[model samples]
Target: MRYLFPTGKGYQRKWLGQDVLSGVVIAAVSIPISMGYAQIAGLPAVYGLYGSLLPVILFALLSTSPQFIFGVDAAPAAMIGGVLGGMGIAMGSAEAERVVPVLTFYVGVWLLLFALLRAGRVLRFVSTSVMGGFISGICCTIILMQLPKLMGGTAGTGELPELVRHLAGVQVHPLSLGLGAAALVILLAAKRLRPKFPMAIVVMGLGALATVLFDLPGHGVACLGAVEPGLPALHLPDWSAVSLTEGLGNSLPVAVVIMAETLLAESSFAMRDGYEIRDSQELLAFAAANLGAGMVGCCPVNGSVSRSSMNVQYRGKTQAVSLVAAAGMAAVLLWGSGLIRLLPVPVLTAIVISALLGAVEFDMAHRLLRADRKELAIFLAAFLGVLVLGTIYGVVIGVLLSFVDVIRRASQPSRELLGVISGQPGFYPLGRMSQAHPLEGVALYRFSGGLFFANIDRFQKDVENCVKPGIRAVIVDASGIVSVDLTSAERLVLLYRRLKEQGVRLYLTEHIGQVNDELRRFGAGELIEEGAVRRTLYAALEDCGAAEGEVKQWIPEEMRHAVPELLRQTQELEWAYGEEAQSKLDAMTGQVLQTLEETKPEQREQELEFLLERGRWQGVIDRDAILQHLEEHLAELSRLLERSEDAVLLELEQERERVTEALRRQHPEIASYLAAHREELEQRFQRKYPEAARHIHELRQRLHQLPEDETKEQR
Candidate 1:
């Protein structure tokens, strides 16, 4: 009950005026839009009005978000219209009226079932691409469906192509077409001029006035004739005319569309408004609203994104705005029936078309084209699927595409080839740091996603890609791994044994909390040595005989005071498992310190490089000292680059150009690989420095012509 009736603890008396005004404005907006959506759903305009009234009231009472408004949304309405249209039911017929409530009831039942089963979590599997595709497809289908009316004729049946064919053959009504065009232009202009303007009200008022003044109805314009309204009756669905089985089957698609659209809107609003709404709670609210709509003999309701946006714009403080909107809708139901009848059908269709213009996602297509081709394919497939097979089939295709994408992502989780940067605190991916290197004879790999049964072999292959014969040890950075299933554990066991057979030891570090227990249960201790699972990455490196260096040698005596004592302590300890290595490390540090004192300042850098090389060969050097030296080298390079036209820089640039030309001529494979991945480089650079990306492209173009210019001169 608490979940159903959200608390109004933060409600302020100061906000009542804003809330009431917003409610009235929202009510004014939703009335015409909802009625238009109802006409799209093959029901009477009164149903759209009734849907706005009671469903809005019920949902506002039961909603988790205080600002969210529920009513006739275009996507679900179009879906219902498409489904019923396919059933050969005539619009506004008694049979169509009967089917709507039954379908609404079935949709309500499905929403309730989803809420009870807590199936909203399944929504996560439906990616943004899928939803975007589904919505865009529905928008196109709705636009296509409404075109006949927009042209001043009866709505056509069948798929988009067939409808287009029918539209080609059908005679166009000149007067109605002009009226629709005028209304579309006015509505669009009003929206552009004042985005917050009560567009539907102004448009409907103008159309009604124009009908009266210009005698539009007498000129062959089809007005919404004789709307009988005064609030819908509360009653259970009469299942005698419609089969429950068929109704439920058809309602499934409608329910899916409603749930998807509602949750998407709800989540978006919640994020935008700085509040949290549980998905399960949202489903329950939807269930209650639709069930209320069904009881009132109206079409199913959903969270209206347009109305919600208005609610936010109007600064609606609480659910009171929805109730106020409901009040306005109720007033219209009793006294405004005549006004609705005065509205031209073409004008109403224009309203629908104008509203749908917002839903058609060209921007989404552009973004996907820039970011991901695979998702773009899915979007196009879902879009074309709808144009050919209808909304239900399109949704099915979109969902399937989303699932396939999920599988593709999981089965090929990105891996990081990790290495230590000279002065960095922790290990980073080698792909990110060019100057970093792995511990000698040790390969560190980090899988950047969850480990599961479906991706076990993928994990194995990723590990193998980083392995080479000379690698004496392999350390996996398990920091990113949150969970591990049994199959993945078994695969890891196999990888351990395989590496063992190759005389390479496998070590695991940064096991996520509780995953350590999971590893042990999988006999990880038996597969590797008892002490192989180290607490830290550096400890693992030392355990594998990779970190061989005295800590004191890495720190110059003067700068030792600036270095944190904890880092010094960490570097001093050779291995994690026992204290035995510490005594040996202390003795080594003493010997290195004695050698460093005998060395002069000028030869100190050279001596450190010698130690680093020796460590790489026979395994022991001051890793801290090598890191400090690498930092100095990086600083020196930065200074050199800052000189802009230093002789050294000029020579390096010339040599680089020579090497690039040589590679282009002699190693086309390498050149081709670079060319193929150039876009990837550009994308990364664009993300990091958007302003520089264009300049970089210009520079590359100029550089590419250098060889051509030389060739032209020679010729």
Candidate 2:
């Protein structure tokens, strides 16, 4: 449906008048500028008009951005002429005319292929600094190339040094030099005073009138004489004459620069106007427009940022403005050729130079220099590449630098030692937060990027450092780790074993499902033992023996009466366990009665208010049943551990111990029973399974070492 339909689905009929007016205004503004750019591309001025006509219409109909006006922009035009000129082809030569259209056609083919491949996504890697440098370089080159014409001398070809040497040898014509000075002053004044004025059109009209009236040619003033006008004859490029290899080689940079400029304009305008641009669709638009340009005898076309800005500032609606602009160009082609031929060459040079002033963009360069040194280096490399080398090679160098930057960032991701704040639930990087408190005897380490081969060694070293003295446990906060490659996973397995051998338990906490699966595949559960994967950071902290703040048992106001009834039912259940359980319940209830009598009547009611207070209450349970359940569960887990291949057996065993303790809290009688038989069970289990019995004994000792205040608080 998107392919079948064009953009601007919300077009209104009332906007037609404004669209037409803006189109005519843009046409007036773009005509002189486009012709000037055509001169930059080493083509006859009429070719600029020809390039702007069909290409503008095609891009308007095809592009997702309604405000984007496609035509010859300074960067690609300068690039085309510079690259061809660097190959020793003179500007406006017959050979250049024959080769340029073929080169443009290849650019079109490349853009279409790029759209098909969805390669627009790669633009993300091209940093803004690199782009700024490339553009600044192009601006410098264009300004240098125009200097000879501005001084009434023939334009120089070759690199900057060669151009500079050639300029030093040329004799400046006084008449042409004076005319160029006047045109530049008028152009700058008009832009500074009134940006909305058609400065190019006004300058062109006055220059042509003055040249004819003053007989400027007789005075040594250079003029573009006898331009043949009219729409170019539509035809496909001659395949037999086209040099496929040379054409492809030259067109690659032009195609890349065009897409970069066009997409940047598309995105900038779309963002300001509150709309979304389909990048792939915009690339398709570029392909179609360049193909149209190739069909005409002209250089390639791309979105012009300056004219597009005018289109928006003038409040153009829909593609109608572009259609109207193209019609304006058509009118010029049909009747304005004679006027174009009469214009002075210096005036056109002045117009091109003035237009390119915006491209220098010093503010952006300064920002890059201040913000990041690496990005600034990329900017300079691109800039110097174009200035010292050529635009094509400059862009290539810039892109390569950008890729290196991306790899450097990925290979050295952030590693943090995390700590929790006093009352905050989430963890933070330790020293970064002033109020954050580190978990005692435990280290929470976080890796803030994908675990891949390039950085896996660094990841291992960082983890090994966490096993410092006094740190008994290490919890890897895997919340930010989105991906884990095979190499990194293997490193993790080895790191776990190393930590285990040093008596420092390692745990992975709060990761997505994929990391969990990867851990299992890497034998995290079996090789590192089952207790390694924890559902939450808090649970891992608890297992590591980190002290928590006070916890209160909550009962809602409406459910307060039900607590007494629950307590009564527990008393009856204790009798089912025979005399031992019954006797313990009898003593607990008797203590509660004695406390109630000792308290004043007023305070006794408040004490009985369970919802409003926090305390431990004795409850009844069958001790034998719970003990029997624990023994059965452990026996089954032991069998499964022996039979299973590389499973998290220790984790399962630890989970069993945790669950048994929770059961003890529920059945206080089971607490007594376990306390009485723990030593006997450990000694017996040690004879059968020494390793497993040692882990169980360690767990019991840790539980015993917990502060009595915390034990009562837990109860």
Candidate 3:
């Protein structure tokens, strides 16, 4: 029962009042928009009200999302209208009415099948840029379709070219044009100033009031005539009107558009509100909503982004909002249907245009332009495709381009020959790091991305190019390579044989244990049995006799005040700044010590905080590392400031304790590793600097024996 009625998942008794108010607001906002989209779908305005009542109630009951609003929206209506125009069906005719319900039924069945198969997972492959472009294109096309209505002419049909041609030939009516232009300006201003306000309903009310005050119809300003007042009867679709195959073929794109738009909107709202939604259950909700639409002889319905945004803005907490909205639509149908007749056509058109304009995704286009021009080009291609070619072709082109881009990226994975920098602990790319150089008689290569058939030849060529004279060993770093296909594994064996013939050894290192299991299964177990697979790059270098000696250490007199270069080269720092990162560390340390010495005692703490904030360089250095370094200089700071050593030690210890607690809270794994390996690290430090190790040992004993009450107060 909970699964079926997911609206009750997190329901609260106190939220009913807010939900009722939000539902009324949503109903007020959706009434005009749905009526306008109904005309776009080639249906009567009453059917739009019919769609809102049942489909929304069904979706509210079945949806996994707590706040998403469902109704007749732009994309599916535009596509259905385009399909009807292509089929030579006249708007509002009996044949058109019968065919639309049949099409809606087919769309419902498709959605049901998709939910059964869990096809929601397939949507992950569609890129965000493609979705933005496709949606923007649909909104643009629909806006053009509504322009003729605003001018006291019939709606335009087909694609952008045909719509433009139709728009070019229409003769404008001055009174209708004036009303529409004024309504559009007001709606736009209200959206900018107070987005949560129900301006669409206000505009509709004003348009109606103006019609009675000025006799709009008598003055040749077109208005929708009186609609039949009543609830919709249960009317099953007459499937005999259209052939099953043709109906399914035309409805497939409509179903896809609805699923994509609705799921994306649902996911976005869930993320924003800090909740989770079941994708398959959402698909089921869409299926139920469309089925209800078909049963009521209405056009297909979908999730409404504008109304959902309004619901969130009004603090709607659960599906009670949707239920309340359904009741409001029913009340309007039963008693207030006559009011719609006085609403001016041009005013309604302007309301729709305003809503569609808001849907255009200009922010997405701007972001893609600034961040990645290649993606921007793809966005443009999809946008242009819809305008010129139509909705289905536009979606197809965008999806195909997205797949092609993915393949292109996979076929040219990043490959680099690596070497050591003078003061760094890890290998770096020889081309980018100026101080890095290849070790004597050894070549280290790193390939980032999965190994597959498409990139095996490139991988082989990179290895061959790096094997110069005197290169006795070629070590492959497989840390970045997560998977390998059978073909790549076979090629790796061939490369191993080739390198053996040239009097050079080949070794693979730093991959997970699963790759060895895969190699053994791929009939290349000899690579493992021959001891060619190593656990680490250093181990491989040692096996090949290339790691022969260590460089001499350059130690400072006061080891506590200065960190060793090797000790500063943490794995994360090396990954962020490959070479000469030691310089950044030195500058950071110097600035910290300088600030401590020059700042006044009263403002020292505040100034140190500001200094840390100003010195942050793109997060290349971690804050915990900086705090640890400062703690190491306790004695030096005491002597420089002429303070008692015990007081300085207590202050530094308090800061260190706070930072350690924060680290444990934010990054438990790193904190756990440091705590578990503290003794091992101390032994390594003692071996590297025996004299400094002895001095540090005496200082640690004195600190550990501090008064227990003082340590408790610090905590």
Candidate 4:
């Protein structure tokens, strides 16, 4: 089977008997409904035979789904029929019927085009909410469309509202009505009471029997009359200018709608535990089916879920079963159409209604009852769209909702602060009951989403809300803060300085390497500081005055035992960043400039140690390179005016404070060096910020001319 249907390698040989039995059962189940669906589609009963053939075999040959069955069915075709008919290609008029096959041909061509374009994967883009709504909408339409046929109208017009109105106009065709009612009753009974009996076959046999026994046509019964027996002659569809162009215009919407419905079914079924299909291959196989339908005088065909499910349940195991079914159907079209004609139209309608009932999926509605209301609304919207407007409108609305939902979710990611438990060592959300308590004086806050511009402000506000009155240490848990934008870095820096002002400590725990790397570039590396951060909340808690051994012992016994596992992750992060991943003590000396910029005095030692560890493992971060990155980030920030003094003034104040602290750290000897080598430092600073350098040059010259002692006195 893998070779016949190789997901990665292409098709292989697999007799898998269930496939064959499935084909036979589905063929038996589908044959009657397929014919009836053809009538509902206003296509010839023989066209129904054309519609039922070959598509399933092709789908099996190319699809990833192990159990998908493709054949003629009611819902999509019914919708297509009504849509096309409304546009004037209606049945009853021989001219219109001629146009039908040609319209189908055009639709097939369009679907083939879709498959060629690889549009199958579009299924995943649709949200579950939209699909729930849209499918319900389609189901509602199917149930409504069946109403008039059950009551007693010719399956004419193929339009729901019109069919009801048309039924009101026609005197009840009693023979047709009785047979439809009987077929409906029997098929429903077979389905509910006797699951093993083939409902399609049972209803069909009874329908044929009743027609023969009652001598039905003598009364006002609508039968398919005398079906012309023989293979439909291989005739090219007249795509002459007027009809071809008109067909193209009208059929495209039908093709798109039908194909979408088929893909939706295929995707849904594929997602189930047992059987899944290759979506890309489905498109091609469906294309071939469409081309085949057009090659014969058939209306468009699609995968039939009910019949396929039945076939599998009946133990079908091979594509040959579909082939066998197609062959049987071909024989019927050749010699049995006339004999089958005596089978009352109501009987056919009953078969169709029974099959379509299975498609309604009330289970979907039950799921809605269990899900969130917003999701329920999406499902209902699709349901209502189909019921009120029709299947076509319903799916379009579904597609739109799906797109909106995806954008909404990704754009608005949730955030939370994670805190390390006092005795547990490992981190959990500070808000969650499992680990609700904050470190005694330390605030361990976890940011759950990526730090992007869209979410940065909310993140800042949440952190501020936590930093109320007497918080001593503020731990920023960056494990959840996976990705970052430069703006996010600037916002982070503002928080870092804010905590510093309250005389609180800021520790970054579990800093994702990617985000930490971005922070490093944005001058946040200096602001957030090194050594202040830990990979695990346990380690961070230990640093923040919690006794390391006691905390370790307190870890919920399950996790307390996994200390080594957690340590491995920490080691991996430290290994990735060399001198940059510095410890407080190791960060001193040659990295004195970095130490000077450290956001906290405590982590300065830890950061230097981290740097030493980094140097030991990897190597040094070039001092010039680090400075260049920081200067560039600063340059970028300077250009972004706060828009107004009040807009982000606190953030601005925080930045100003960090800069002040860094500059204030210059040693007396370094200060003396700055005065003695003012020109060299000035040139280097100018090279980094030429415009600022020009402004500072005059001040330096004025200071030098005035005498350094006078400048020192003014300071």
Candidate 5:
């Protein structure tokens, strides 16, 4: 019993007063919006009130959600109205009234079946982007449908094109248009100024007062004629007016919309409030509410986001708020129904339009635009599909698009070439990390996402592209690949054979134990027996004779000249400025040399500094690298000029010393940073390339001995 009626589980005495106040607020807000939605559903406005009373009470009694409110809402109503228009049923006529109740009965039946089947879990596949787009599209379509009524005409029916045509042909009624425009403006302003205020009721009351004060109905402004003063009568849905097949067919989509929209909203509220809702119970609650709606001759009903938000804002803590709201509506139906007759049709249309406008997912569209363009496209497709096609087709298009997006991503997941940085422990993507370089005769590859028939070809192609003449071993980092299908396993075996034929060993590394079992099951157990599968990349590299050796000898020949840190920085420059980065640096060096030759001796330092500033070389290359390159260029210039080598070198060294001193004085921090960075790079180079470090030390010691020998001979 506690599980069935969970609302009282956490109830408190103090919450009752707040819940009652919130319930009243919800009733006030629901009056105008539900009435508008009833018109959208092709029912009389009074049915909207009936829907609010019984359906809400039933939902409150059964719902696992303590705070979620259910009643006649926009999506299900718009869907019902669309189906009616398609069937050539006239709005508010006897046929529409009969068909709508039958349709509501079918919708209730569907929800009950869904609850029984525990089918609420299937709703997880519906993406938020698709829902936002679908709802936005529905809201826009209903807004267009309501526009004609605001101008003293009947509401437009069918999809966007027909609605546009009806809007284009609408004859302007000055008084009605003015009243609608003013009501719309006031509602919008009040929403902005005080979001939680019961402004819809206030606007509705003002419109009703205007109708009575000025006799606006006499001046060609249509008003709701009269409302019967009583509670709704309970009756079984009469199905003789519409065929069984047509009623069932039309009602399924309405049922789907109600289920999708309500459950999504319910789940969102549950998440926000840090509570858990039973999805199956929520479905049951919807079924019961809609069945109650059908019994009362009301249109299909669903959860109302606007009223639920208002309830939460007023600190309504339990389902008592829903009961209180039902009572408030019952009171209006019993005594205050007469005032609804004085409500102007245009004003009601404006209120409906305002409510629908709030329902549109404008903020969602904005977020998708900034975060992911692909998701935004999905949103647009759903929105446009609903606008161009009808609501059901729009939902189909959005869902189809979502599934296609999923397939597309799976078919082409991110893949990268892995390499090792000199001082870093783990393998990194060669393209992204500047200091990372491939080990000679071995390729480390990382493929992100599962291997399946759809993506195996991509995986094979990427691996083949990474293979070159000297690459004797290929190690795949399979940490990202969680699962493999039969087709992918076959393809993997073929790839291994192909690589083996070409004298290249293929090893799969860093995969889970399940993958090994899968490989064995797929008839690739030979791979494991042959020692091609390993637990880690380092182990694979060790087997391939790549790890625990001189890093310079293992690295590519082109990368062997510089320290790994410097090589990394240079690669970064190449990535940013393109492959011509080295050529550009040389060109800038030539320009600086020309400036130094052209300038007077006194201005040479100033000219060189100006040339360096203009070159913007520091943005691309480090200060230490630039200084080393300048010294090399000066040596080359002296050799090309064929001057006395020692004399030319002495003069160049003095000039360099003076300029370096001036630069250090002008920018001491930069000079200090470059000096410290150079020292760190040298240390890393010595650690990574000990043999080369020893050779350089020997050359420096020999040079020092030669100078001492010359001094001894002179003595």
Candidate 6:
């Protein structure tokens, strides 16, 4: 199980049963709605049924998650509907029918290409706020569009004028309206009951039963009527209709929109349920499903969030559930597709209304309240754009806003002054602490972000902005800086010269080694005198003052407000065994220790590098020196430990808990890596010399046997 998804095997086995039941129930309830969606997409009702059948099978076969049921979904259906409606391609027309296959083919190919490109990881870059706003917009549009369809012909088709004309042509179908409302009510109840016991399936069944029992076909109620059943026809994706000048018109853009929605839906529903599949794979899955669906005269298809969620709720752990759903849907299309026509339209409408209840954006609204003003503006703007303009245009607008935000932030930059307070030890910016006292003269300013071309001038201006008269020196705390370019380095040289002329010394503190190497290579280091670059600000201050006074001032009276980088993550700071790093280290060390037990005078040489990726190896007062002093104290001890040779290295590792607890009393953020099998420790003590092993064992005992006199004096 750990190998499958980096966890235990138990969870996967458990969810398998849940997947099957969830798939079946969701498919049963979704059958009717799929047809309505197909109708909206300008496909024949049978095409929707065809889509529910074959595409589901293909999606199941290709998807990573058993529970991910891909078929015709509402957003893309409305998208297709709105696009074709604008194009004046009404249903039952030869032009519309011809274009439908082309659209589906286009949608399929694009999804396939996206899947091939492995675009799923891009989902991480999409903030939750953007997704929330996008979904809210989609829901708003969908609800408004469905209002007419539910009004029993009062709201069906046409613009304001055409709706008015249609209304005049057809009177109020009261029985149909009441039945639709009832379907909505029952559908909601079933979802509330449980995913497995679908109210929609039960309610729709009752509506059909009422039709048969009361002979509703004799009344004015509408029905799904007959749909033919068979295997899907083979299809070749068409680009013959595509124009170089105009491209494929609406299909190309619509296809992109559909693909985005499909991937997003699959990730949120399928991946959230622990489906270990790539985004691109799901994209290919959609492509295959749609291609197969289109060829068979089925509507275009994509991943279904509601159906997928139902499967997850039921504990469907694999793609097998999708296969089952497809089989069941196929049987329905083959056997009872015609009986669906006998069901009243009002019942169908009610089911749709109830299904839509699940689409409410209450969470989105709550999150929006927590968002900053800028993010809220973006969310609201996106919401309005989709509601008023349309889905495609709204996303474009949101993207545009995001780009502007990026440019705006880059153009305006910030810096910080890093310093330690008087009679205090640990370093921090004095400015940000509202009540904290500054150390009078000293300031350790940081250019917090990277030094790039866009912000170099602004950075320099802020450097000057921070520097005022009578300051002895301005320390450019290069600890926060990661990398520097030649342009910035040259500018730094000029600034260094200017500061020197003014009798204000410039010092580079806690410099990244590689960056200094780069500066040396570029000869930028020579522009500034060598002595000005100190190991740390304290040592720099002390070289100009008395060293004894500075050395005595190093220890802090209390803990710093902000912890150091290595200690920032509190869990990582813990001394617990069986941790990720510790486990890995343990495994590594156990292998070495096992070899060490029988090894001769083995001479081994390893070419290894420990690049200073974050911190400086050298400083005014090197922290590494402080760390080494702590390690030396740890190494010299008098007590001894007994070895149990037969025990697994893993079991033996847990004994470090006692020693770990003792260390925490002093350096509370210390991490014990006995399980982590730190190679350096073993190489130096356990392998290099026999006496080192004695030292480790003795120290383990010493930690538990701290001298009472020393402990009391320290307290």
Score candidate 3 by lDDT: 0.76
User: What is the C-alpha lDDT profile of model 2 across 97-145, one tens digit per residue?
Assistant: 7777888889999999889988777665676677777667766776777
- For candidate 2, the per-residue lDDT at 686 reads 70
Candidate 6 lDDT, 495-559, residue by residue in tens = 77887787666776555555555555455765323345554555455543423466335435443
Candidate 5 local lDDT, 1-715, one digit each (tens): 6555678786789988888888887786677668868988999888999999999988998898877889987678878888888999999998888889999989999999999998888656667787778767867886887788888887776788988999999998988999999999997887788876767668777888888899988899988756688998999988797788988888888888777767766765676589988889889999999999999999999987666766766678989899999999899889888776787888877866776677678799999989999889998998898888976587568668878888888898999998888765566789999999987899989988888989999999988987899998999998898878889888888998999999888988766667776777788866765557765565567666775554333434453343433333222323322444456556657767776776676666566557555543332224444544454454444444444334333444444455456546534434554456446655755786677556545543543455655534422
Alpha-carbon shift of residue 337 in model 2 (angstroms): 1.7
Error of 1 at 88 (Å): 8.0
lDDT of 3 at 403: 89
* Highest lDDT model number: 3
Assess every candidate by TM-score: 0.69, 0.68, 0.71, 0.71, 0.70, 0.66
Could you tell me how far off, in angstroms, the CA of residue 204 lies in candidate 5 after the best superposition?
Answer: 3.3
lDDT of 2: 0.69
- Count of backbone clashes, every candidate in sequence: 4, 5, 0, 45, 0, 27
Q: Encode model 3's per-residue lDDT on 159-213: one tens digit a residue.
A: 8898999999988999999999999999889888987677777888899899999
What pairs collide in candidate 2?
A: 525-648, 526-647, 530-648, 530-651, 531-651
TM-score of 5: 0.70
Candidate number that wins on TM-score, 5 or 6: 5
lDDT of each: 0.69, 0.69, 0.76, 0.59, 0.75, 0.57
> lDDT score of model 5?
0.75
Between candidates 2 and 3, which one is better according to TM-score? 3
What lDDT does candidate 2 reach at residue 81? 88
Residue-level lDDT of model 4, residues 60-175, one tens digit each, is 55665555567776655675567556776556455545656676677778877887787766767877666656654554555555556555664434335654566567666565
